[model samples]
Target: MFVDIHCHLDAVKNASEKIALAEKENVSLIVSNSVDIKSMEKNISLSKRFPIVKVALGIHPSEALSMNEKEIEKAFSFMEKNLKKAIAVGETGLDFKHAVTEKRRELQRELFKRHISLALEFNKPVIVHSRNARKECINILSEMNAEKVLLHWFLGSKKLLFEAIENDWLYSIGPSVFENPAVQKFALLSPLKNMALETDSPVLFNGKPAEPQWIPRIAKKIAKLKKTPLKKVETVTTNNAFRLLGLQQKG
Candidate 1:
């Protein structure tokens, strides 16, 4: 079974249709992440409606720094109240590329650490939303002794990727493999055991938005890069994703 390890189903208008298409393509599961409280609820509701959908609840990096203490507390409360309904804590991390103020960036980093602590406390996986702050994110994850860290749409330096590999942290690659040379090189150099497939849908790639069904294409690209067979790549990626997301392997 195929799994898109990171996606935002809440951002799509025809999300159900997309999920149905994934099912049709033998994509047995999808791990949908959220950007904030509203989207977290939306993701949870979507997961409830579809048995194959799993949820990761947390605020996005861009939204994280903007949250006041009361708002942050409210999110924490809500998460504690609904912990059983979600599978992970994330789409949360530092983003230096977008936030305008140093203060906001600092707040975002603080929130990232909070989320990391929460994930460790819960013993749940985290989906990190690292953009240009890869070193800081990696350092924070290491300092926090965070287990089950999944870097979504990971586009860090080769050194950081190697660090993640050394630590056995998971990395998710999206459809960017079709055109992005750096991402392609990362795939080529990465062992299949350390990587999994994802499509951050509604996020444009190469001037076109991605779809969940493009996971197979991503896998095919990986196979070509790794000089392995498509089926082998598909099988290993599926297993890696299942293990990362804590899903049982099918008989």
Candidate 2:
């Protein structure tokens, strides 16, 4: 069985079809992450309809930047109320690439901290998105002493990557490994036990929309990079994902 640790099922058009395709490809678990309250609710609904679908509830950093105090509070309240239905707290973290100003970056950091606290409070794993803010994100996670962290699509410096690896934080490798030298290097350097696969579904890669069914291709890339058997890569990554998400492994 394969697992996709980070995907935006709510954002995908015809998500049911996508889920079906994933199942056919042996993708047994899909952790659909949300960027807002509405997507969170939709993801919950999708989880109910699709047995393989699970949810991670949190506001995206880019989305949070535009929300007012009241809206943010409302989002927090909703997540707290429905956290039991979620497998993790995520699609959350800093993105300094878009939040260019110092003030904006600080706000994102504060929001990131809050999400981390909430996840800690609920004892849920966090699926993070730290674009161009990997160092800052790692610093905060370190200060908070957070465990059960999954850094999705991480392309940080080798030093920072090694730091995360040493801390035992998991990193999600996506389809970019096929084309991105940095991601391929990440797959090669990071131990398979500390790595998992993600497609970030419905997101374009090389002008093509990704789906959970692409997990095998990503796994193949990793196997090739590590010069290990495909079966070992599949077994290790799927187990790593299930363990990180606190789910019992299924065949």
Candidate 3:
């Protein structure tokens, strides 16, 4: 079984069809994340309709950049109320790469700090999205003693990547591993024990949106990078996903 740890299923036009395709491919689980309350609602429905779908509800960094104080409060409050229905506390973290203004960037940081606090409060893992501000995000998480962190679509300096690994943080890579030298190097040199795979569906892959069915190929690439067998990659990554999400299998 394979798991795509982070994907915006709600953003996809044919999300239901993608879910069916994933099951046929033996991609057993997908942790669908939300960008806002509306997407969270759709994500909740997806999880219900397809048992393989799990959820991570939170506002995106770019979305948070435009939110006002009241809207942010309402979003967090809703999360506090509905966290039980989800597995993780994120899709949150700083994104200086996209937010572009110091003021809005500051706002992003503040909101991200709130998310980290809430994740600490709820004792749930945070699925992070850090772009240009990887070091800043790592600093905030470290200062807060965030115990369960997963940096999805991670792209940053190798030094920072190693720092995150040293802190025992998990990183999720996707199909970009083939094209992005940073992702390739990160997946290649980083310990497989601390690594996992994601499709980030609706994300373009050679001009088309990617899907969960592509997880096996990406996993194979990572395995080859590490000079490890396919099963080891599958086992280690699957175990890591279940551990970070605190998922349990029932007979």
Best by TM-score: 2
Q: What C-alpha lDDT values do all the predictions have?
A: 0.86, 0.91, 0.88
Among these predictions, the greatest lDDT belongs to 2
The alpha-carbon root-mean-square deviation between model 2 and the true structure, to one decimal in Å, is 1.0
Q: Which has the higher TM-score value, candidate number 2 or candidate number 3?
A: 2
List residue ranges in candidate 2 displaced over 4 A: none
TM-score of each: 0.95, 0.97, 0.96
Model 1 residue 218 lDDT score: 88
Tens-digit lDDT track of model 2 for 51-144: 9999999999999989899989999999999998899999899998889999989989998999999999999999899998888899999999
Q: Write the per-residue lDDT of candidate 3 for residues 1-251, one digit (tens) a residue.
A: 88999998989888889998988877888999988888888998989998999999899999887777898888888888988888898789988878898888888888898888888888889999998888899999999999899999887677888888888889999999978887888788778888889999989989999998899999999888888899999989988998898887544
Cα lDDT of candidate 3 equals 0.88
Clash tally, candidates in order: 0, 0, 0
Candidate 1 at residue 202, lDDT?
Answer: 72
Model 3 residue 241 CA deviation in Å: 0.6
Ranking by lDDT: 2, 3, 1
Runs of candidate 3 with Cα error greater than 4 angstroms are: none
